[model samples]
Target: MSYYVRERLPPRSTGIANRDQDRGRPAMQREVHLIGGTRSEAIRLAPVTLAMREAGLLQPVMIAAGKHTGTVTRTLAAFGLEPDITVEGTGNDTVEGTRTDNGDDPLLRELDELWSVRTPAAVIVQGDTTVSLAAALAAFWRRIPVVHLEAGVRSDDLSSPSAQEPDRRLLAQVASLHLAPTPLAAMNLLDERIAHTDVLVTGTTVLDATLAVTTRRTPFQNPAVAAARTGSTNRLVLITGYGSEAGGEPRMAAAARELAERHPDVDVVLAVHSGQVDALPGDSRVIVTGPLSYPDLSRLLCEAYLVVADSDGVAEEATAFGVPTLMPRDGGEPAASLTADCARAIGADTEAIVTAASALLTSRFRRDAMAAGNTPYGDGLAARRTAQAAAALLGLAPVPDAMPVSVPVLPSGAHA
Candidate 1:
């Protein structure tokens, strides 16, 4: 199922094109390439791959290296789709080593090889990572259409701390199709003058991923859940955030420590980012857990009394799970407005975190209401929907009733 594009001959263009024309179709056989370097990227790519497979499209080719590749391969295996091609470069370990003067590298070389061999109808790139940008450029150079997932997300301030504005801008300009998560995101693309015909508000594939994990129930529980349940009746606060070298880690740690100190009866679990686990503090009250599988992590969220994170997506997922969250507020906009009573924004200071934690601990009625307000982000069938959409774009047969899949929630403490 794997391929090396550089080593193979290009498929017969006349035959492929005529095949589509004869069937009064575009092309059923398409190639997808995902570019990124993180466990999160791997997780995000899974649903797309699943969607493609369910829609009868070709399995995707992944371009990544080092730990990132391993994580991606593992995620694909978890969903039962082996990559058709995996591209890794010699200098992939270092940023400078991986980049040439013109920004082309072994990864791009592999992509070129894949394109030559398959003549794929399109390529799908997700996120705002360097790999994605590079892949998009490569695809554009090759004259292949590119679909951008999670497009139209703008932080608005490129120079602001921890801003991904540049990547967002670059993606907005190059993407042929923009799969926006919300209507607002779609509007952002429209204001930027992107063709309206190219933008689609498909909710978020992440919500589909979240719902998929939540719907599955198993009796096997991890030790962490057992400990959390039997250890004490103390309030549980789950803290997560983006793990960039910016102030994200320190801010989360300081908040966790403050919550622990101010509320002795509470247990603060810091779900450290997979990249920054070593940076966490050594404190009994602040329990450190490794990066968990998505389903396992969702179950942990269900057990939590409150969740604290700076990530908007995590905050959204927490709300879907009915867990109240404390997010860092961007000046002027209260976090509650974005997430309802189930969520709030607090200062990174110890006093601010402690105060917010104390208030949530005391408000039983409010907590109950927020929990009730939580609903699955969408049906669990995002994978199928995305697959059908990508297939249609590629001129494949349309899948029927391609809506979100709905699944029942697992019992408390269920684990993979």
Candidate 2:
């Protein structure tokens, strides 16, 4: 799942901290190989790479690693990055953009082989995808330090139908540095007996990407989606990426149809994850489309009246824009998935969704109050903090101040 390439650095096998004290080594020998994940997760690491490269403290090797070649490549290109080494899966190896198991054993072996020849000083990974876990394992096996970006995120409901839950927990075992997105996430690592110094609360990096892309507006490819933003009487209930868990599930679709029926004035755009279109509602007001490009998605969030999503990263984005968001998981979401201000954890039941939807729709004050809440996500400085943490892990420079993150206000209770 992970793709890796170096800047032709002479492979240094581990012992990075010791090597740092050595007389000036070429920047290549200080290579910090960053493995690219999905577009959402990859953008989080993008700022870190740019920071590191700009500092000239360590060689930032951007590697594109994912099943969806086009998606991965496009994401890298978004930040003016192209993987020095690109790994593409063909035949049964490849999968759609959404994360589902695509046999990472081969990725493990491939990374193992690459590192055996030319090892990076440290390997950086993001989130809890197979690509992140595989990169961590491969780096760990070689005694290379693994820097985990967005570490210590755990779902409130283990039975919440997300496949990547365990991957984050297991990642903590192998990671040398945990760049937790929130103080709550950092506390989760500390509770597990991880060293206090090893965890840095950097806030979520998605906001950085979101803020950057929001400046660039693009016409939505689907006319229906574009129309949702323009109509004065129409409110956009943007449902982003039902995710791998929502496939063949009628509950969400049924809920969407009911919401459409209840509110004839609003436009409900169901931007579904690829390969899960079969479960879409049959209502005319519920405009269904495949996954949206990052720019289009950002534009929708800016223009949306309300948001409903299950993808873990959208919570951060919704918070960034102060958009009132509803997490549809029945078990609720982790602390990172909700903000103090505008988000609520509404379960997957049809009636519950409709009730929450109706309340948000009927009351302008409620929606505005949610929007007025302070963003729990970062003030867009997470990447700079993350870059400093990665450098400090190599003993090259001091990590920038660990920005304070407020403990998330969970609906039922704290995720901690």
Question: Can you list the residue pairs that collide in candidate 2?
Answer: none
lDDT of 1 by residue, 40-143 (tens): 66666677776765556654555553225666666655455555455654322324213223444565566565556555566777766656766777677777
What TM-score, computed on C-alpha atoms, does each candidate reach? 0.76, 0.81
Which RMSD values do the candidates have, in order? 5.6, 5.7
Q: Largest lDDT belongs to which candidate?
A: 2
Question: Least accurate stretch of 10 residues (summed lDDT) in model 1?
Answer: 407-416
Per-residue CA lDDT of candidate 2, range 153-253, in tens?
87643443344666788899999999888777888899989999888888888877766666655467567666655544577788775553444235566
In model 1, where do residues sit more than 4 Å from their true spots? 1-28, 57-67, 80-82, 90-106, 160-163, 218-226, 230-235, 242-266, 273-286, 329-342, 368-379, 397-416
Instruction: Compare the candidates by TM-score and give the number of the best one.
Output: 2
Model 1: per-residue Cα lDDT at residue 101 = 30
Off by over 4 Å in 2: 1-23, 26-29, 89-104, 156-165, 221-224, 227-233, 243-265, 274-286, 337-341, 406-416
Give the clashing residue pairs of candidate 1, or none: 5-113, 380-405, 381-404, 381-405
